[model samples]
Every structure is written in structure tokens, then in C-alpha cells.
Target: METATPFKLLLVDDDPQILLGLEKIISSHFSGDEILIFSCKNGLMASQLLASEPINAVITDIKMPLFSGIDLLKFMNEQNLACSSIVLSGYDDFNLVKNAMRLGASDYLLKPVDEGLLINALYELKKQSGQLPSFTRQTYSLTSILKMQQLLEGLIGSSDISLPDADDFEQEHHISGQTSCLMCYVDIRRALYSNYLTMFQFLTDRVESFLNSSREIPLLNPTVVYGRLDTYWIFLLFTDEASFEPEKILEPFLALLTKDHFKYSFTTAWYPYAHIRQADEECRKGFEKYYFDLPYAPSDAPANWQTLSESLDAAAAAAAAYDYASTIKNLELCFAMFNFLSPSISDVRKEMHHFVYSILNRNSAFIPIISTSKFTDYDLFEHIEKSESLSVLKKHLYSSVNYLIGELIESMENKDDYVIQKAKEYIHNNYQDNLTLNDVATHVFLSENYFSTLFSQKTGTTFRNYLRSFRIEKAKELLTTTNLRIYEVAQQTGYNEHSHFVRAFKAITGQSPGDYRQMKK
Candidate 1:
């Protein structure tokens, strides 16, 4: 068996006895690797020492004489250090613990820490740090996050980023295992960028601290990844298959944030375990569901992310099938309904931004034509607050939706026929269950035979052929891209019989399901 890398430890305290005590306890409890202990009376000395040496982990006292632990934490943040930190303080220093957490300390222990607790914290940190052989005292900077944000901004109007190809992401990210959930939060109002940044920083700080403090449930430290588009943040938490309930862990933190800070309201969405690399796509789906399909008000009840997702998926498909005039008319009704149902401009804006972002992000036909310039310009709340006439607001809503629909139509004209677009939409809406071309044609008010002929004429394929192609495409996606079994794929893509699915798979690709798996290998 191969031995894991040793963790480099840095113990900081003003008192020699306390430092010696920690050294003794850590030496006895953790003997597999070398422990580097740094005795510093103040934060300034610790900062200087950190500047000169590599410290994997830092254990410091909160109430040191000169430079305090909080002061060192601020320095760490400014310096772009990634080392995990533990704060050692008196029991009465609850406020200090909060401050340390806000500054990104991984965990904190009371003075005269228990031997077991100290060892547990160290062990947890070791697991999180991965292959880091030693702890390096370093500074933390927001440069990487800023760079990622910039990259996201660049994707705002690009077509290639549409709905993100899950297979492409798996190949790029090199993800090999299952992920428990994909979590995401989006700030609809662009003006709140600064506030969003602060909230994100706070969330990262608190989550890191919480994970470091707990030894029983070891979780993979989450990373900030780009999502379907540039407007959201994604985190992929790899948890045990049997022990995942991400909502339970996330709710308290969300509640604290909403209650403590009254300036802005927040909405959250989550997707259950799927492929780890498809995290961005799942998060995008979550954002669309929460922001578009669900009600905007904060509720005591948890949002049903799966239901919202299904609804939005259906709505998007329906919207895509409308003729130019019908499309405009439907959007008008949607906006009118929105105007009547939503109580405030803030709520309306949130809903509209979500709806528009989701539709624009998923449909490549709409993105290039919709003016990115105006998406951020209008303040719906300002209009709602100033105008008393419902007529004016209704008109504004109509125009906004109309503009979006027009952009969609214009983009689609160059890429696909109207019937083909409608057929694509139908496939998307019914992809999860048993569906047939005749069923789709009936829904669209066309004769089964006539619709099939038209679909084949417009799309260069028979309706049944198209349905098979679509199902096969989705099945191929599950096979190469997800861990879901062949039977599950069959069920998910509308085929009920496992043997039927296998025969169809072989007929289309000239390979058995097992053979396809081996080919992928």
C-alpha cells in the first residue's frame, strides 16, 4: 500500500506553554508525518514568517497581543493564500469565532482544546488539502474568481455555450465519479454585483469552516466552476451516494442570510446527483426553474426544483413551437398574466430576467439577435414604482416579451424551418416519457399522416425516424456521459421495454449496449 503525503502543520500562539502543549498533543496524536510548529506572539510576526516559509496549515490564537488572529486572517485573504486555518480562542469568544469565519478560517477551537477534537480537526484538514505534502502559509486573493467572472462575461452572447454539451464537459473536466448534487444561485439584478461578491465570499468562508470543523462527514471541498452561461456560479459537491441531502445542509445558511440581510432577496435551486462534469448544465437548469417557473416570494416551504425544471422545460418547448404571430400573442398573454400576478416591480423584474435568460441561454437561435445591451439597462421596479396605470406596465411587459420573441424568430429563420423548430420543441417537452409522432401531431392539431409528411419534408427525415434519432441521441448521451444504466436510459428516453431498447440501440449504431460501453473504454 502507498502511504499518503504528510501534512505540514504550523502552530501559532503567544504563550510558550500553550504552544508547547499543542506541540506535545499534535506530536503524540499525529506521528505519521513531520509537524512544523511556528510560535508567534503576534499577527505581525506570523505574517512575516508566512512570507518567508511554506506552512500547510495554521493554528493561531484569536486574542494575541499585537496583531490578532483576525488581523492575520485579513492578511491571508489579501495575500491569496489557500492554506486552511484553525483559530484557537477562549470559550467566551463567540464573536471572535464569527469574525474568524467571515475571514475564511477553516475551524476554531476553544483554549485548552481537547486532544481528540484537535486531532480530528487536523485529520479533517488533511483530507481536504488532498495531496499537499506540507502546509504553506500563504495569502488569499480574488484574482482567480475575477478572471473566471470575466470569462463568463465573454460568453454572454455566444451561441456555442447554449445549454452546454454535457459530453463535452465530461471530456474537458476529466470527471470519473458520481456527483451527489449540483448547486447554484443567480443574482438577477446586475447592479447587485458587489453585494453578490460579498455574499459569495461569505458563503465560501462559512462552508469551508464548517467542513473543517466536522470529522464525521467528510465532503469534497467545492470549487467555483463556470456554468451554462456567464451569469451564474456553480459548485459541484461530491458526496456519498447514500448520504446526500444537500438541501438540508444549505437551508440554514440561506435562512441566516435572508433574515440577517434585508437589502436583497435571494432564490436558490438544486439538482440531484448526475454526472459530475454536467454540474454546470444542471445548475443552469436549476437557475431557470427557480427564476422562471416558480413563484418569487420567500417561503417557509422548500422549492421543488425537479417540478420547476420540468415545467420550464415544457414551457420553453411550447414557446418554441408558436408561429411568429402566435409566438407574439402567447408572449403577450404570458406578460399580461405576469403583470396581474406579480405584486411588485422587483418581483416582475426577477421573473422576467429569469425567463429571458433561460430561453435565450438554451436556444441558440435566439442569442445572437437579442441585444445584450438592453438586457441590463431597464429597471422594471423603477417603472412599477413610478407608474400607477396598470396599462403602462402591461404595455412594457408586452413589448419586452415581443422583443424577445422577435429575436427568437429571426434567429430561427436562418437555421431551421418553422415545422422543424416546432418538432424539436415537441421532442424536448416529451423526451422523458413514452411518446410517439402521432401523439405529438395530435397535440399540435395536425392530422397524423399530414404532420408526418410535413415533418419529414421540412426536417429531411420521417417523423418516426426523427423520434428514433432523437431518442438515440439522448441514449448515446446517457451512455458516454452518465453512469445511469441502460434500462434507466431506455425509460428516460421513452422506450419501455429493455429488450426493445437494446434491439433499437443495436440497429441504429451496429453495436450492442455492452459493446458501445467497451468502445468507450
Candidate 2:
């Protein structure tokens, strides 16, 4: 007798209350041990759980923040994850429900969900659970594509490390010796919303599914390698038993990718298979021709790109130091280099994003204010992407830089004023003590020299003068309010010597202490 498979159901909604209620309703129908229940507040969480766990079904809301239920369904479809989906939608989201269905959602329920209908859907999903494919999450030692590329490049550069034979990879893909091979390079312009790894995985699965199902070519699975700049290098190996043209496969593959016309633009280059590493090198050179080298690419493009990167780095450092002039100068230099290079539009957008991200990351004070002012990192990148030309991007960058610098200056001033106010309060409360600038500066966590300069800037008076004037004001108040002896008043007002107090008081009020007392009376 075969063991029964444990049914795992995931409930996804942005509403905590809805998730709890759904869990309760599902729990009432099935025992906890027999049917495992999981809950998440967004589609992102659901996708993660579905990827790692054996989730039999997902009950996800059609709309949510960050990642929508439709996006989750698409992710499952893209990853070829074997889980049934039942989407929850509002009455107005019929179109979204239709999209979810198209993306392999088994069923859907309207909001204020009917418990009976949900139970029915679960029962149907449970019956078909055994048919769902088992999934093992692919593990990677390093998740970042850039890091992986760097590591591979380093290994390739090292004298001791040896590159693997082409036959080795071909044998791993189950193709024998001297097999015909075609290397396909697919470059997609990365979207602002998706991370590189997720995009790469989706493309990989989509390509594998398409190529694996082809009937014309006696094909082994393609050896997929992640490449630089949102590109994939796929090596398709064919058995010696077949005679097929590479274009037959390449043309349809390109067509399949071009279907995502809005989110991605496809640039593909194919070549006869050579050494694995050499194939990548050739593909990169070919891709550079298509992706980076534009009609306007001049002879000095490499030098210009180098200068642009260095200038952006200098600008980031200048921004961190709050040197607005140097920051602007370096940024203008970057723009000049960038325009002179006249790289591809994608390169322009990508470089500007790095420029903005670098500056903001270095000067973190600009991040929150810029974010609150509706110029978030996402918005910034979107603006750069949408710019028709370098001039438009330059204008946007300058406007944003100016706004952030203004905010940074105002923020510094306000903070300094606050610290100065605190210092004033401390002096007012402890004026009778012999408080020096060092003592008060330490209390406020600032160096004495900096505090002195800031005090003068914010209060419009020197620290020593401000203290003397404050003490004198206190003394004059006491001279009229209480008839204490002059020496006693001096002692109470942060002054040790009576003669010095009298001199300071005359300097400020233009009268001797005794005369000031009489004048006030």
C-alpha cells in the first residue's frame, strides 16, 4: 500500500484578518497533521514558500502590494513549480481573475469568500495533489550573478585553474563525442522591478521548457550559463543522429522571448559551438557590438566610459563631504564623457542608475528625504529609463541632485540649530558653574572647536560672548529681584571674581554692576 501524500496549503493576503480566517476555515475541514497550513501576507512570501516547501495549493489574493497574486501565479508557472492555485479577488477584479486563470490558477473565489466554495476547491486540489511534480529548490553557493561572473573570470584568469573540456559538459548533458553544438546568446534589457537572479531563473526555465518540448531536433538539454549585463549563454547540444539547422531553433526561441515586448527587449546572437570559454568570449564581443557599441560609439568610447565611472565615484565622494560645487563639477564631467561616448540607451540608463545609487548610498542622509519627497530610488531609476536622450536624463539628474543638496543643507542647519538650543538650555540651567566650551561640547557629543564654530554660526555670537551675556542677564535679573551683595551675585552667576563680573556686566549693559542695580531699581 502506498503512503498518502501530506497536503500543504498556503493562504496569501495582505490582510492579517483574512489570513487568520482562511486558516481557521481550512483547519476546520482538514486535520492539522493531514493537511499542513501556511499563511503569508504577500505574494512574495507565498512564492518563497512554494519554492522551498511542498505546497499542494496556494490561495492567494489577486491584488497586493509589491508582488501581486497574479505575479505569484506567473512565478509558479515560470519556475514550473507544481502547485495548484486558487486566486481570491474582489468583485471588480474579474479581469485579474481571468489573467490568473490563464496563468494556471485552478479556480478562484470572490471576496467575502464563500467557505463552502473554498472547501470544494481545496478538495479538488487535494485529489489532484499526487499528479503535481515534485520540486527540489536549486541551491547556489553564491546568489549574485555579478559575483558568480567575477569568480568565474578570476578562475579563468588564474594560471593553476584549468578550464573543463567541451566533451565534459557535452557528456553531462548526455550528448556523446563530436556532437553538433550551437551557442545562443540572449540579452534582455533588465526591468526596474525584477532582480537579476529571479529574471535569469525565469528565462532559464522558459527556455528549457520550450527547447525540451521541441520534436524536430534530437537535442540534449541546453547548458545555461549566466552572463554579464542581463544576458544568458545557452549551449544546445545535438545528437550525431540528427541533421538540423541552428536557425530552426534560434528563430523560434527569439520569437518566444520577444513575446514579453514591454518588460524586455531581446537581442540574440548565435554561433557555431567552440570551446566553452571561448564561446562566452565571442558572445560577449558580439553582444558588446549589439548592446553597448552604438552607431555613435567613437574611437575613444572606452576611455570615455572609464572617465565617466571615475567621475561618478568622485562625485559620490564630493556629495558625502557636502561639497556641492565639486559634486556638480564631477557630475558635469561625467555627463560630458557619457555624451562623448554615446553608448547604447540601455548603458546610459544603467550607468545613470549606478551614478544615482552610488551618490545616495554614500550620502545616506539624502535617502529618506528624497524618498519622502516622492523621488525614491525606484522612481529615480524609472525616470532615467524613460528619458529619451542623455540631455533629458542630465536635466533630471541635476534637478534631483540640486533638490537633495538643498535638503541636505537645510537638514544640517536644522540639526545644528537644535544642538545649539540644547547648549543654550544647558548653560541657562548651569550658568552659576564655571562651564567652559569643552565641558558643554562634551555633553553634546561634539568637539570643542566644532561646537564653538557651530555655536557662533547658529547663535550669531561667539561661545564666550554668549556665555558672558547670558550670565550678565541673569545677574541683572537677580540684582533687581533680590538685593544680594555684588560679590554674592557674582558667585551665583558663574563668575569667581567680582571685578571680572563687574567688567563683563559693564561691557554688555554699558554700566557698572552697582550702577546697573540702581538703574534697574
Candidate 3:
């Protein structure tokens, strides 16, 4: 039978009773494990011992003489020591607790600590440390390991995958005896897909730095793996044991990532202890759910599968039936909702992309058209940088939304339905020449009658009537804004016959062009 490897531990406390108590508790609870309990009356002695010898983890009293736990943490961080740390403290030391956390203590427990809580903390330390052992070993190349570690860290930050399979990983790397937890799935909105690779690489580096400084887990065994699948990125976290709520670990990390780096929000799906073989499929489901279910603004962190599934189903239904006009209205509403959330521009962009893509992907044809357009390729950062004010950003978003909707409509197969667009384009390009509904319909490859019906359906007016209204609106503008004569206005507004223009203008505006101009004057 294979012997269970004993976990190495180091305990530091000024009081003899506390040291003896921890020793007894650890020995009794973890009978098969190796326990190294060091009694130090002060932080100075503990620091000397730490410098001289290797230790897997440390449990220290906060108020030790000459050197405090915070001081020790600073010293360890400066020395770049790789040891998990927990603080043992008395109640009513709120300031100390806060300072210790700032100094990088993984967790703090009050005096007379519950045995279970102590054990759990130790287990968590072991799990975190066990998941990341390469950071400590001498045989691994630091640069290559660092790169891999960075990728794993990004996966942890972006998705809900908890630790990779430590046993299999250890065997491959020739490092033995490690345990890990689950994998996380991270889905960035497809509109942001172009930035996914670079952004993830940057995020991965930051996350690794964070995890490296974390005293709660060991860095020697990286527990996370960041993988890419099409437009989404996946993160797998490996750990010795799964304890504490997984999201509790992930949500704050994502919040920190969004706050510190990108202005975008990230959605994660967590699979605790997911078998390696099933990870890809499980992650796909998670990615689909996240992409489809993201809210208009960041909400409370999601906790379970049921809510995620429900949200996705509702969003999919909305996408399937969404109209461009309705989408514009919703886009404005979503902008308002984002302001209410007070999220950074990146977060807002993430939500916006998810919402837009969910709607756009409803039609398969819409995807290819939008994918090939400049509107879909616009960079949020570039837009934000160029915007003079929030109002400008709002205008930019609205314009892009309108453009995307127009493109989708343009890609439809109904030539008759496109008469209005053809008419508008034609009139825009050839307003100085003779132009009419017949000319526009023929240009758009539509017969007069069918084009009239489709144009009316599209523009809510017959082609001839619509042209008359459009030309008259332009004539009124030129009448007031320019010193052009009535005939010149008619010619500029697409009517060659002056009398016909006057009659048509009067029929629509209930006033001759001269009367309208005088009224404005």
C-alpha cells in the first residue's frame, strides 16, 4: 500500500500553551501528517528560522514581541519567500486584522480558534500551496513555468474552473503528491473577441502576480490552466481540497481584475472538481450560458446553475424576436442602466457587447454581415479615448447601434424591401439630376407596384409620397438656410419641374415654399 505523504507545517507562537495546544490538535486531527511546530516568543526569532530553513506554511501570533505578524509578512514578501501564512490573533484587533490582510496574510483566526476552522485554514493553505509547487522547486525553468503559471492564473480569474488535476500534472512534471480543486469557464462577449487574446495575456500576468503574493496558497503547484476555445477563454483551477464557496473566491478576483485593468466585465461559470476529460464539454455549456445570460449591468455575483440557465433562456428568446427599432430603444435603456451601475467603461462595454451579440446571433445571416463590417470592428478603448465627454460616448454607441441594425436589414434577401434605402442613397448621390420613385425602384431592381408596397412597409409611406415628403423637407431647409430661389430649391431637392414642386410642397406641408420660408423668417 502507498503511504499517504505527510503535509509539512510550521507553527510560531510566543505562548507555550498555545504552541502545545496547536501541536496536539494538528497531530490528533491529521494523524498521518508531519507537523513542524516552532515556538518563537517574537517575530524576530521566527524570521531568523524562516530564513534558515524551508517551511511549507506558517501560523503566527499577531502580537508577538519585537516583531508583529504584519512585520513578518512584509519581511517574507520582501524576501520573496514561498510559504502559506495564517494569522492567529485576539478579538477586538480590527486594525491589526486589516493591516495583516494588507500585508498578505491569507486568513486570520481569533484566539481559542475552533479546531475545525483551524484545520480548514490549514487544509486551504495546503491546497493552495499544493496546487502551485513549481514556484518552489529547482528543476523547473522559471521563465517557462512563469508563462504557464500566468496562463493558469488568467483562467482562474476569468472562469470558474478550480485547480487542474494535480496528480496527473505532478507526474508529467516529475513532481509528486499534489491535489487540486475545479475549473472555471470565462466567456468574453464576442464583440470583444478581437481583444480577448491580448487582454487575457495581460490579465494572466496580473493574476499570477497576485497569486504569487498570496500567502493563502502555495505557488509551487499552479492550480489553474487558461485555455482558449474559439472566442472564449477557459480557466481551470486545481487545488488539494474544495472548501469555502468557489464563487466567493472568484467574484472578488474578477471585480479586482475589472477595476484594475480592463473596463469590461467578465462572466464566469465554475465547475468544482470537474474531471479532466469532461472539462471541455462542461466549459462549453458554461460559456454559452454566460454569453447569453449576461445582464445589462453587473449584478450580484451569480451563485448557481438554475438562475444562469433561466437568464440565458430569456435572453435567447429576446434575441430571436428582437427588432432593430426595439434594440435601439433597449440600447438607450441599457446605457441608462449602466450609468446607474456606475461601472467603468470597460464593464459597460462588456455588457453592451454581450447584449448586442446575443441579439445579432439570432439570425445566422446577420453574423457574417456584421462580422465583415467596420461597425463590428470598432474598439471600445479607441472610442472612449477619442470621446470628449460621456455624451460623446453615448452618441458613438447609439450611432454604432443604428449602423449595425441598418446593416442587418440590408443583408436581408428582399430587394423590394430595400427600395427606401436605395431611394435615399440615390437621392443623396444624384439630387441635382432628375429623380423619382420609378428611377429609384428600377435602380434597386424592383418593379414599380411591388417596390411601392415594400417601400410603404419599410418607410410607412408610398414611394412617390415618401419622395415628395423627403424632397419637401429638404426644400424647406434650403428655403430657410440658403438664399436659393424656389426653382433652385426644387432642383436641389430632386424635382426638375418648379410648378410640380410647389404643388407637391403645398400638398404635404400645407404651405408654398415661399410661405414656409417667410414663416421661418
Candidate 4:
């Protein structure tokens, strides 16, 4: 096996400060390695460097002035530079990141980038270049998350888990808990699933800032950021009394969210778990209501035309975010708004027709509730009016909208399945080469992280594990049939180092290659 060339990294950002900050953070991780790091203010300079220098990877910002990151990505593709790219994206720039992903960006890191994340991206690019992976802060973060989630979830039984002693809780939880605690779970509406880390940090800062300024509200201790899953934030609030109601914290939180004008709709609920014995009950019983109970109060009286229209519009926007939960929840709010009007069955039916039509306009291809041409006529409304009761009308409307959600999910699934299958085919046809996950992900036009996740979801095995299994299987067939040295067999099956191949083979097969070969003979 040959040692790989030293890694060369190109950093491009319109902001000089950002470029310097990112380079300083990333370079610290590779101080002992033979790696070259270069920084430029725009993509044009990065492009020039790409043409003249041996750059193994690039970290570029998306919204540069003269030569944007997207433009640079396009140039890289057209000229086939083959450098792995990591796009620096903002929350609003997700659409652009999607386009960049399709244009072969290896992965993306969000703006106000975390130091660990930058190092992790560079370390990952290094691995894809056939170099040994190094320990990175990103690695530590991921490892810590796994350990924390495991310990926290394990401390409580599936049935019981809310309260532990303050001393033990503070020690085990890694933070101080208020004598009275409110555990608030917040789910952001319309946040991209891939932006988990950024969302976590953003929510953390937002909540902390609000807590800091709002002292008038009876809060004993500062808000503590609890652990997070992919897109949700779990926060804990402390109060002076053990019998404190969670709504005290939740109400103020909601008020602050409204005041701040957050773009995403959020569902927030807090559980009171101050009593040690009731901890399990609070967590287990309240979880259902927390997730499914209507976040907004139900209405019976007539809602104004403006309010109904606004609710419907909000639901439509939720659909665009691909937030099916929020869409349905908003639709439920809309239905409540409609029923509050105490309008005639005919009036409700009329409004339903308009609402459904609005939703279908965006998803007409996925939901076939009506023909595109038929949307102009009143025939669909007449059919809907035939429903005998409000109960029946609500059921009909719910099922239909659910079908739309199902269709939307399925449409995306089909496209994802096609991409994963293509990737699998590519891996199969080229298993003998020194292939990297980035190469396959790049070939299939997906960000490496997304490709890995989608592939695992579809196949129930990770890309690396799947590739290793395939390669080892190929090596087995060759060892049995052909007169080849073990090292040659290892190379043909994509292992660059003989010892690494032997270790992997034994791990998978429970036998050395030589022993397996002798047994076959």
C-alpha cells in the first residue's frame, strides 16, 4: 500500500474574519500533519487556487459576492476538479444547500460554525482521501451525545423516569436543577432535518437570552439546556417551590417567542416533575398529551373571516416547510376556526372546498383529489356537501388531508429509493476499486451525510459496513477459486493495507484469510 499525498484544504468565505476563524480552528487539529490550509475572501480566488494547486478539499461559503459558492460548485463540476466540497450554509440558505448537494458538495456545516464541526468535516475529508482518520472535537461531540443519551434514558425505566435526588440529579445530569422543575420539550416546525446541530445551538441561545431578561416571572434558577435529539430541544426550568406549575414557565416562553418573531411554528409543553415518586407518571402519561393534545385551545364561537383565512394560510405555509405535523395541527386549528363560525353545513362545505383546493394546488401531482381542470368548477363542492353531518365532514376532510401527507412522503421516498439503488449499483460494479463513500454519494448527487442516512434507512446497514461486507464476499470468492496472494486478494477487494484487510476479514468471518483459504482447499 502507498502512503497518500499530504492533504491540501482551501477555505473560501466573503468575510475575512470568518475565514481566519475557521482556518485557525481547523489548523489546530492538524498541527502535526503534513496538511496545507489556504484562505481566500471569495470563490474566484478559491477557483484560481483549485486550478493551480493540489487541493484535496474545500470549505466555501454560499453567498459570496463575485463568485458565489454555487457558482464555484458548478465550475468544479463542469471542469471535473474532483475536490470534495463542504458548503457553509445559513438556516435560510437550505434551498441553496440542497442545490449544492445535488451539485456534488460532500457535506455542509451551518453558519456560526462550531469549532468541532469544522474539524470533523476536515477529518472526514481526510478519511475519504484514504488517509487514517484522526480524533477530532466533532468525534468527541458525537461520542458524548451517544453516551449522554444512553445514560439519561437508562437512568429511568421505560415507565418511570422524571425525578431523581437534587444532589444526584445535578451530579448525573451535569447541571444544577431547581427545587421545583419544569421539563419543557420544544419541537420546531419546518426546520430541515439535516440542520440538527445548528437548530440545537440556535434554540439554546434563544431560550437562554429570554430567560436572562425576564426576571419578573417567578423563576428561581436559570434555564438549563437538556439533551437534544435530531430536531427537538429539551429544556429544564427551575422554580422555588416543589408545587410550581409548568405553565408559569411555558406561558412566558410562548410570549417571548411571539415577541421575538420566530419564523418557525413551535409546539411547547412542560411537565411538572418535582415529586420523586410521580416522575414516572408525569413522563409516561404526559408524553401522549404533550405530543398529541391540541397545543391551542378549542373554540366554539364564531371566528372572524380574517382569522380563518390566516389559519388556513398558516397551514399552507406549513405544507411548504414539509412540516406535516404542523400542517395537520394548523388544519385542525382551521377546522376549529371554521366550526366556531357556527355556519351552515353549506357554508362549511364551501370553505372546505376552497381550503382543500389551496392545499392541492401545491401537491396536485401527489394528491389526486380532483383533476386540475375540475378545480375550477363547483362539482367537487357539491359532492362534499352531500356529507350528512359535521362529524362526517371532519372525518372526510381529515382522511383526505392525511392522504395528501402520505402521498407527499411517498413521493419523496420514491425519489430517495431510486438514488439509493443507483448508489448500491455503483458500489457493486466498482467494489474492487479503492472507493470512498463520498465518491458514491457524489456520483448519486447527494450530500454525504444525507446519502449515508437514506442508504441506512432503506437497507438497514450503514454504507461502510455494507461496502465492507460486499468487498469481503468478493474476496472470499476469489480466494476459493483463484491462485492469488492474500495481499493481492485484499487489494482487489479494495483494502489498501494488508493488516487492515486481515483485521476486517477476521472480524467479519471469525477466521484469518489464510485459515479460510486452507479450509477451502
Model 2, range 366-457, lDDT digits (tens) per residue? Answer: 67876776645325565676554455455556666666776676777467765775687678768899999998999789999999999988
Off by over 4 Å in 1: 1-354, 372-395, 406-416
- Candidate 1, residues 421-444: lDDT per residue as tens digits? 666776876877778777888776
lDDT of 4 at 515: 97
Error of 1 at 361 (Å): 2.5
Ranking by TM-score: 1, 2, 4, 3
lDDT per residue for candidate 3 within 1-521, as digits (tens), equals: 97655566677778888888988887775654445455576788888988998877888888877888888888889998888788887633668877877877877776765564576566557667663243332233435545555444433334555446434455564432234344554443221211234345444554566455554743344455554444444555556554544555565455544443222222233333333444455545442222222234424534333343344334433333434454444444444444444445455455545554665665465465555654333333344444423444556555554555566566667644445554666655565577666787787787877777777777786766766677787788899899988898988887778899999999998998889999999
TM values, all candidates: 0.33, 0.33, 0.28, 0.32
RMSD in angstroms, all models?
27.6, 18.9, 22.0, 27.5
User: Largest lDDT belongs to which candidate?
Assistant: 2
Question: Which 10-residue window in model 3 sums to the lowest lDDT?
Answer: 286-295
Output the lDDT of residue 202, model 1.
40
All candidates' lDDT scores?
0.58, 0.67, 0.58, 0.65
Q: Residue 144 error for model 1, in Å?
A: 52
lDDT of 4 at 52: 91
Off by over 4 Å in 3: 1-170, 173-180, 185-201, 217-224, 227-234, 247-255, 261-521
Error of 4 at 60 (Å): 0.2
Candidate 3 to truth, TM: 0.28
Rank list by lDDT = 2, 4, 3, 1
Clashes of each: 14, 0, 33, 0
